[model samples]
Target: MGFDLVSRVRLYKVLERIGCSPKQFDGSPSTPSETNRGVKQGCVQASNLFGIYFAAMLRHAFGGFREVCGDFRLNISLKKTNIMGINTQHPPNIHISNYQLEAVNEFTYLGSVVTNDLSLDTEIDRTGSASATFAELAKRVWENTKLTLTTKILVYKVSILSTLLYGCATWNLYSRQKKRLNIYNLRNQWKMLKIKWYDHITNNEALQQTSIPSIYTLLCQQCLRWLGHVCRMEDGRIPKDLLHGELNQGSRPRG
Candidate 1:
């Protein structure tokens, strides 16, 4: 809700579309293209279809990269490098220096699921399960009478909510997804607080006892906080551009 000023869907799409040619990237014709993290192998998000130019760019970008003070060369692990088509049904096989990268429908990046469908359902579902596991594993702590309710709530936040909200700031949440997450959070709370369905404790009353805001509010705060960080970025920064930039030409193919 707090992200009314910026479209999370648009921003996420652009993040996958942002990239540059090798020459434009490192300011040298022979140098490999550098990514935001500057790692030897990092994600490169192309703005166009995966085809000839994209393959060529990858080849050029993978060469001439080495340690600054040594002759060490970087060898990319083809097993780890995967390519996928975002909206297109058929993406061509991309060959880089005689090695063809594998194509996938989805992949896990930084502990989150990324799919061609551009949806967060899988990630959210997985996180919900993980949070439930976390809560169940701490059953003893939840039932400890020696521990105050405040202490239990703090543990819940640290152990379960932390896992559930990982990378949530960048999520594009719809009403259905939001409701699903809230249901998971509420169920976890019920178990932790030893509230049975027959107890007839309203969800609001349970929340009031724990003094925890709804998952929707927590998500909004996270998104707004990240937006503030992006707003302060200098020009030509990828995160800032991903938030405000648009493709110069060509639209993504229909699925």
Candidate 2:
């Protein structure tokens, strides 16, 4: 059965008592000579309940949870429960009681697609497609004769661009992907301006006419702003801790 508010609270308490923690990354350090880097590279702590190393612990926790559910007269749907592996070469075989859990290569969590390889290609494609769909849905607004160009631009930014750039602050886009997304953004802007494919106008000129920055520039700005915000977060917060963690062990990557 799905967890109600009270059940969720109880579950949270149990999880906390069992020492469950959030996922963490131990990044490489900057200087090769710095021997005192606290957390070493490739060192990981499996704080997640679903970690493979903690399968036995998870099974025990699940048993406890099952007992709790029984007391509340709630039915647990074993078939609906799934385990997903990230960057795993082989699928893990795990069981709780007599039921074997199924493993999946990818799953959607919090509206984001998480895959075994942890690559963003699928996510980018999905976001791009969704953005295009939203833009197409707003085609009538783009083509409306009564609306001013400024108003249409506002609508495009608020509706289309916002959708396109959702969660972009966390993206680490390659040059080719950035180029492709920028081209798509430019095409949409051209469509809104009623410019033909054969139009001799340059991208810079089009951007100037629209009075909007390029998609790449916008993404960079958003990422920088998000970094600033994370840096300013108070200590003990996960994002802040990750940002300031002393895990890097070698020379930083040269961009």
Q: Which candidate gets the maximum TM-score versus the true structure?
A: 2
lDDT, candidate 2, 104-181, per-residue tens: 887777567778888877777765665666557564787788888999888878877776777889888888888878
lDDT of 1 at 54: 33
Could you give the C-alpha RMSD of every candidate to the true structure, in order shown? 12.8, 14.6
* lDDT for position 31 in model 1: 52
Candidate 1 regions exceeding 4 Å error are: 1-72, 96-98, 246-255
Model 2 earns a TM-score of 0.68
Off by over 4 Å in 2: 1-5, 8-77, 131-135, 248-255
The 10 consecutive residues of candidate 1 with the worst lDDT sum are 1-10
Instruction: For each candidate in the order shown, give its overall lDDT on alpha carbons.
Output: 0.71, 0.70
The digit string of per-residue lDDT tens for model 1 on 33-60 reads 4334321323353223223233333445
